[model samples]
Target chain A: MPERSRAHEWTPITLLPLNGGPDPARLADSFLTPTSRFFVRNHGTIPIVDPDAFRLEISGMVRQPLRLSLDELTQRFPTVRRPALIQCAGFRRSELARVRAIPGELPWDEEPVSTAEWGGIRLADLLAAAMPDDAARHVAFEGCDDVEREGRRFGFGGSVTMEEAARHDVILAFEMNGEPLTAEHGWPLRAVVPNVIGARSVKWLTRIELRPTASENYFQRRAYKLVDRAGATTDAWEAAPAISTLPINTLICRPRGGERLCPGPIRLAGYAWSGEPGGVAAVEFSVRGGAGWRPARLSEINLPGCWREWTAEVDLASGRHDLLVRALLPDGSAQPADPAPLWNARGYMNNSWARAVLEVRAD
Target chain B: MPERSRAHEWTPITLLPLNGGPDPARLADSFLTPTSRFFVRNHGTIPIVDPDAFRLEISGMVRQPLRLSLDELTQRFPTVRRPALIQCAGFRRSELARVRAIPGELPWDEEPVSTAEWGGIRLADLLAAAMPDDAARHVAFEGCDDVEREGRRFGFGGSVTMEEAARHDVILAFEMNGEPLTAEHGWPLRAVVPNVIGARSVKWLTRIELRPTASENYFQRRAYKLVDRAGATTDAWEAAPAISTLPINTLICRPRGGERLCPGPIRLAGYAWSGEPGGVAAVEFSVRGGAGWRPARLSEINLPGCWREWTAEVDLASGRHDLLVRALLPDGSAQPADPAPLWNARGYMNNSWARAVLEVRAD
Candidate 1:
């Protein structure tokens, strides 16, 4: 269960699963997105399990199957905090949808992406207690929320390799921003896997299963792949690697859209991030309709798995303008200037240059 | 001193230093660029160094300075063969020049790049014999050729991190394609530093100096950097990173422009390469302007420091067409679509989508 950014500020992209987040303009003002401003990305209904009755079951390819109450899980392991970003696979799918229609998927704009401090018990300690078998290769998680998709009923599920699950930052977070988790954000328990698509961070989590293979959940097996054609054969879906790391991306948050301002020098702000070990090196912004790009100064040093804020100012004469932003990766690659090249069946990784249309009015 | 590619077939971009390579269409016909067709990128006048008098001096931050004659370099070290690609920093500058003027620099058009089998001794073996001190961080290289610029005459020089220079593949190559090197190709000896810009390879090897910092040579400190403005301040040049690893790039060699073919299905071929550890993951091509892109089939599994050949076909129905190719890197980034945003004072790393135009007419 994920919490809404703000009661009125939040706009639901999907009502059935209650998926939504705060506006982009609201995201530019702070180094860390406030807990209330964190995006909620749900694939199913928010589960309402009580903390007293909540029991996280550890089973599958482990030598011991243990059930721990919330108190036992919190007290047995030392509490630590990790600040990281959570971005939906379709964070900027709307831009892609403009190139080609994406049916049956939410047209996410610059929402469903935010950073926050997560306090929790390290998943490695819990996995060690369970005594995972040597044969175990993947750690699969199942949330309590009921997801009814493709005319089938099942709990939301996903997985990560054992190597990733054992990482120090991967945790079973019970608190966010120093407060107990809200119902919408996996109330009593949840799993937070950093530097990956948000779908793998199962919210309202209750089950942790270790297996010799990846989880067979539809989300992990079929939905998250970068398939090019619609209704691809099963082999195509299975052969395609599941989307793991997100691309280096940037978003223009200020002047979110359709804004009128007096002509003159105006400050623009945004955020850029990359899941690669070498995070975003630099970001450039253009107000000249892709004619030229200028570097934006970044504030705060970039931390591993965290996005950095950037700002730039440009003088605008009275007129309409299409502002664009793109990130430069350490590999000497930059985000594409057009979206048509990035369009795919699922609209995943639409890291094409982001654009915001602005109208500069004379005083 | 470097032999021209079949004389009539080679078109010298610059006559003084003798810079040129075979037409790219000749490159796509073979996986390995023929030794005679290998690109010659010289920054100065090739020197006529007699083999007996050619001494490669290894000094600077090393415990013991050692000078080895050509005979000693060969007799003391075991012979090895390594296959690698050598790409000029201005391989596609002509493409960028189309978007913005690039004065003075050669307008390279898919030339100045090639691959060949280099036979020589591992640079690591020489470094071991020289015993570089702990304080040594960079390995600088200088050639026997004479370069004149800034009212001063000096040898062309550049450097790489000691870690990169010590790679198993970096070699002091004396043979190309199992034959003695031509004077044009650094007859006595040349250093082949794999995966870096060709500038660092340093033709006509004369010196290897281990240093506490990067080489102060004009090419290393100022010329090969990615400066945005003309006559950049010394501080700007010092702060900017010298062009090192080449970007993931693709070029269409088939139908090498100005082709008029009968309307029908036509084959397209090219090469794609990246300097990243995780090589080029995929390459996509477009025949419909920039409307859509299709995956191209790559041949000969990619090897470290080498480029892979790719081919695709599209139906052309009695009209003009602009074929384009773009490479996808493992970091989830793609070659940019337009060159306008990549405009810089020196047209370095213009990895925009490569295009080749054709006029398909009816008989």
Candidate 2:
């Protein structure tokens, strides 16, 4: 075996449902987060599937249902490589849960995200072959992994609008970074939809359904939404859109909170990203507790659906200091400064400014 | 002249162009903000409109151009009364400006909004009468007021998509609070587009145009947009969407910051409003700088496009304290606690938690 899964390094939020945050230092400095260092997020149990027998079924409001094996899917369709950053919608839930009570949610910290080159066929080409019906407005993706919510067991599933399904970057990938996806990651086949929450990037792919409305799957219909009210009526849940378009965000990696630092010039680095078409225009840091802000340089090479690395320099004194970073999107939306305003019932999409308190000492 | 036009009590942001914020204390108590206490926001000099002679033109991408007098407009169409809370997109920009310099735009505080019953003809009905062409996707509103920007004079103008134009609350108002239109308040006619930024509701209406794209007016195309970059390219501006949909916000009227009072049980009251369809579902306040947040009781009577009064009581000790309030929208979005993340180049949509510091002094 080529070493072992990077499960040990990950801080476990839950073991059975399998969600973990990666060690920030190992994952931070690199542009493409290694598969081993990538954080794992799953809503259900990982299933064992036979690669030869695995068939991705495309059905529902299409002219005809399709069941294609891995060979047929890879050989028959036009393949493309897409680089995408997958983030749990609840990436910074811990920060928000600290400020407010987001009960029942696994309090995710600043990990649950990583970038990789995914090899797949464009979902559009596959949809075109399937021939969607005129009335089909949504396309649902179902995974083989069984997820239990409220005692009933079902596959972890989600749906996207037909327009979203047709985006050039939305794909069904079987490979990550030139290697076949590991079991912890989506194995055999998986959807690789960039720019949206990772939950929509369903794994252990089994079935795809085109429908007139959104998927009735519990994950799509009830969960993965940003409803502010508790005990929301079915109508309220119906009205809310599934969380999409990752907000402008920054991931501070080098200066880990509470890490010991010398009282001198220190390197500040992280990745800035957004789902907005304008992309991340700038990433700024405020070492003086938001009293002042200075711009950080973005990586010269940047791509959509991938995080751009950012670096800056700041002088630190022998004291405790909280460094703040905010990503500015060209579309005019920026990250909020405090987590208190971003507190939600589900603790999802807490794209507030990334704040890390550091300890500067004389060693 | 209606008690000196209530101008003396208003705080002037600009003198000649005439933008002013109403006294929040006076305007806060009333559900329907009185005409005298209504905040005035103008981009250009108020023009003297001759009601009888003035012709409202509906042209461009239509079956035929129309020029109807006020009498024809009122007598020919079905008149309706609409009550909407009109808020400048830059409301609470003053708080953001303190954190970051948002040059050029007016620094409006929390007082640039008020609600009054508007009497007018439904804009949808008017468009139906004009017989818009299928190619028309937008409806442009042109005001009589002359606004000069970059040495070019253009009537203050804006455009709304046909989807927004067809909203039930969009109207051409000739009366405010049952009184005849005032010069500063869109003398003869004004477009009252509820649930949108106040700028889209062009006052002193002179003409309307149907087109395939948005208005090319300075306010519509360039201004009133959220672009985080400095010196954004023309293409960036073109790609950026104009600011619309007043964010969920709260206005804390009682116990203004820096007011001295005895430390004891104090009553807190504010108005929460939203342009979103679900409106403000809940309003919450925290006395201890966001250590915790408690719910505030919403008023019994609430209306769409109008603020709902909320009240609460908190026991305080003798010292300095800060009060923060936030409005929660049913759509799963909440206000930010700090202004840093919401700070844009234009300082628009500062829906961060409303913060007010109070001093408790022994009497």
Candidate 3:
């Protein structure tokens, strides 16, 4: 049984089953999310692992299988630090869930994502020592968390393409925001995969496998995959490709729904990024419902696979307004104008145009 | 002797002498500033008062002088609640302080202000019973706090015009955010003069004096006044009229100065208000050094003598740029484009155009 812990201070307006993100008002305070304020996304009970007894085993299609303890792993490899923004595949799932009765995953609304400074040994460095052949096309990671589904027990697992694992930015992070990971966010070891959907960054990591194909674990095989909007059968599950990168996306942090706004200048702030090669190129806002768009000022630093912060100031008059945000990606693709066309089971990859209806009163 | 109390939770970024305001980011979270996050502007030590023994005495230019206990005060008059934003005249004084050596006052920045829900007996209600004479032109409020300066002991004091005090919004507040005031925030009662500088909202209830002219108390006569920037002499201090209504102004809450921003959409959020009769009419933003300006979306509720929230989304590319915000009052006056014209010796009333230099990097 998973042990219950004291409540976290960073929990925002939460949804059910342990999914919450920091309020955007607080998120905009700094460039990096402090450990106390970082978002927590957990699918199953949090496992309490003793770091002294923890070991990460590397096997599957490698020249030499090795088991390395936490201390040994740290002392043996050169550590590298990188900053990345990890967004959940189900981010903005709340928008989709609103369109229909999409069941299964936790309904998220721009809170399942956060940016952090990660430090760890490069996964590629260890893989090179183990010497995988050309047949090794993917890398799979498994965690100690036991998630029960339909009375069957299985561990949380995920995989990424070999090319992704080889990137210098992809690290096996042990330190989050310059400190050891907290138990709530995979204390001992976890993979920090940048620019990809958060599900692939498996937490509480216990094993790494060099494989000829993607892992067949429940999450890798059936879950976190993009499927047809109408398909809910086994055949559809078997044929769909696993969801990997995030689509061009934007999230409105201010002027949240149901808020009473005064008539004057209001600030619209949010985060935007993409999984495409060049990342998010531009983010724009439209006060009118898709009729006009104004470019939001982007941040100066645009790292591949990272979300950049943007800001703009617009004058608002007394009335209700539909504030819209859209992102232009490096691949020239943009968020769809409407989410109804992309609705799918499990509410995954619901990156449609982001809008907030604001009430501007002139009291 | 002054009382030392436990630290307060609502203090903003500070310079010295213990004056602070709400963080704009936190202030933007909701319409009302939480009690724990409200701004504190203290020139001297906070007084520890026994609420049971607290009495507010009303005298001077009235038909019948009256002294009422906390209990009697509550029972005799109807309690009213009002939501108002209180801002220090020195808000954004740092912008002016940066221009030159403006000494004596705490070096304030983009804080020194906050909005709160205050509940108390209206001064008007109590005064109606006292029946003020025709000679009363101003109402002076004196506090129990003993502030020592130049080896003389005197309490903090200020006054408003008789008509101003007669307004319904002016209250002897005993509760903040639905709870009794904290020790740090003038526990038993404090005068809440709406749409005025915070100094006028004297903390720590003691005595109210009706007078034929504005109070000659040191603060009312020598401090909290507008003076020419070049006037640093006693002559300048002697000639200037005490500062009264706040001018139209705006503040930038997010993208705080000296922050690292990435390339993408950024959100500019802030608070705006005018002490003039009609309140804030509009707030505009400029990135091209005031060559062109864009309007920000204002919140719907625009209360008189209170600040309204505003937001705008502007697209920005990678580079260093200056962002500016200005407010337009209902009376057709706008914020000065440059702050240099408003610089003063005490750094009071520094409501020039608010500008923040942001570094937009493409890392």
Candidate 4:
């Protein structure tokens, strides 16, 4: 029964589920996955929670320590809904597998992702109610999940400066897909930090603490680190800072490799995303490996934190071709041409230029 | 009973309802209303539709006369959803009331508008299936509603050239707000041409006829026209082409006229929209009329056919201040500085600059 419940908790990919995790082969579909079908990454067991009984406790360096029920929170403050994309820092970990066998953790291909409409009360409202001490600088969130790293065990915890937490669209979400939160999906409540790494969106949220220093958890401090050496392992996790907003990335979602398309006007569609609040600045696609590029018409409806859908109509010639898709950030940073340059020991944060090969035939 | 039903149908506001018919205000609380809450502007009675029995017949200059049911239409073709803003050409007709007592239809003050997520099959897909003949020039849509105008009777009808209907994102929407269309708000299905005038979104869609000419209905050719005459009773409707995409416009939704604010940093919020598919190019806010203007931070999420939310933080001193907001389109057109220049006999298509006055208190 427990295994059956776990199976139900797992979201299935309808078109093409990642075999072991995510892989480059899955790039044929448009990168934007419907909210229900997005991949989930869990550091610990999913907790069962009751919305009526949920209480988010605010304590530590503050003038007032308060515990508010979900009902009280909703009625006392205004609610805002924003679209945001939540991505794991270790997305595309499968690229490291090609370099060398890194035994540990899920051999995540590239599926560590999803975007959703998050509606909730702002964390700033809670801070206003708590009245943090003048010296307090960091706002840390502790989740109910526990994980072991190396030989030490700690709760899944993370923190950001108080100033970062006060941004406009940050929220505590209690729903997904217009329904109440489900177990394995942060049942009662979860944090939704738009344009930030998914690790910061602590699920099964239990407590929020305002402190003068950053979080001291193993997961927050020692794991999820990216090192410079490709094959070298290191205990220098302390040196790496926690990931925040995602860098620019693009994925070609249709016309799989080796697929034949009759020569004509073909509508190309895909998704582009960035962790920055400004959204994707630009997306360019090339049919002949990096030879010629054209801009994709971006969807006008850019919901904050949600993926932007893009489309372009191309007149394909009868020939074998390799297609490449790349994205740019508002700051002008682009995906690297190859994944080899970003290779790291932990196999985290792989945002390389994505490519697909196809054959075009005469109509 | 009729009066009670009328009361339920109309949303009362400070300005008189246009056309001496249903009230323009909606019951929804949000600043932008959902499709169900949007005011319907029909020149004819509501058309009762049977969803299961309904058939959208495509004929005339088409190579094939195709009849499709709701289920078959949705299942056979891909579905598309996009956010679109629909506004009556005479949204703020009551503003003309201040200049002169020009009696007009739908004395709408600030209502007669809304934005909604429309989902359905694309008109392009249906047109592709029908495969119009080489000489087919225009596509005409006739609604089921029956009406009498200028001593002539006809069904609500309109048409766009084949080139116009083939544009991307033009859809035949059967659902709004994730639900089936409501009775008064065009049940069964309706045409939604993004970035086009409200009249083009013919409701109660019954038949689509491919023709070689434009629509000839009174509403299509005679009514909803924009003429340029200064004197009272001069018809401007015949002078200008029928209204389609909205002119660039801005609305002051907060800190309304005569409102009071405290001296300090005041946040200004409003909505701006453009009828062009390119969307709003820029929006500027002026605290002291047009002395010095600052660009408001436009909504990063630029959804097509939807209004963009803009905000600006301005420091205030203790005094009275006149606030003005104006929008610019991609083509460099702006909302006229004065409403008088755009006023006409029917008082339609007013895109005057928006202004609000407020006083700031030191305390």
Compare the candidates by DockQ and give the number of the best one. 4
Which lDDT value does model 1 have at B302?
53
- DockQ (C-alpha based) per candidate is 0.01, 0.01, 0.01, 0.02
Q: How many clashes (backbone N, Cα, C below 3 Å) per candidate? A: 7, 1, 58, 20
Model 4 in CAPRI terms: which quality? incorrect
Off by over 4 Å in 1: A1-363, B1-8
Tens digits of lDDT, candidate 2, A1-363: 021243345677788988887877766534556566678898889898887778899999999779998888988875655468999899989998888677788877888989876777889989999999999999999999989987899988999999999887788987776557778888877899888899899998889999998888998988888888657787887778778888888899888888899999999988888887867889999888887889997653356677877889988889988799999988666798788877767888989899888999997
- Per candidate, native contacts kept equal 0.00, 0.00, 0.00, 0.00
Compose the digit string of candidate 1's lDDT tens values, residues B292-323: 88999865235567787788887889988878
Residue-wise C-alpha lDDT for candidate 1, range A167-188, written one tens digit per residue: 8778899877555777787877
lDDT per residue as tens, model 3, A56-124: 999998898889998888888756555678888888888788888776667677777777767788888
Evaluated on chain B only, what are the TM-scores of all the candidate structures, in order?
0.96, 0.96, 0.93, 0.86
Interface RMSD of each: 24.7, 27.8, 22.1, 15.8
lDDT-wise, the better of 3 and 4 is 3
Q: Once all C-alphas are superposed, what RMSD does model 2 give against the true structure?
A: 22.0
The C-alpha stretches of model 3 lying farther than 4 A from their native spots are A1-17, A229-231, B1-363
lDDT per model vs. reference:
0.83, 0.82, 0.78, 0.70
Give one digit per residue, the lDDT tens place, for model 4 in A251-274: 566665667799888777667788
**Model 4, B1-363: lDDT tens per residue?**
010112224453432112322222122223334443566677767766667788888989998899988888889876655556777777888887677655646677666667776767778889999999989998888888777776777778788888889875678987765456666557778898767678888887878999887777667777777655544232444445776668888766666677778899988776788877677888998999888988997654455566776778999899988898999888877788898877776788788888888799877
What tens digits encode model 2's per-residue C-alpha lDDT throughout B164-277? 998767889987765666777887889999888999989989899999999989899888889887678877877888998888898998878878979899998888888888
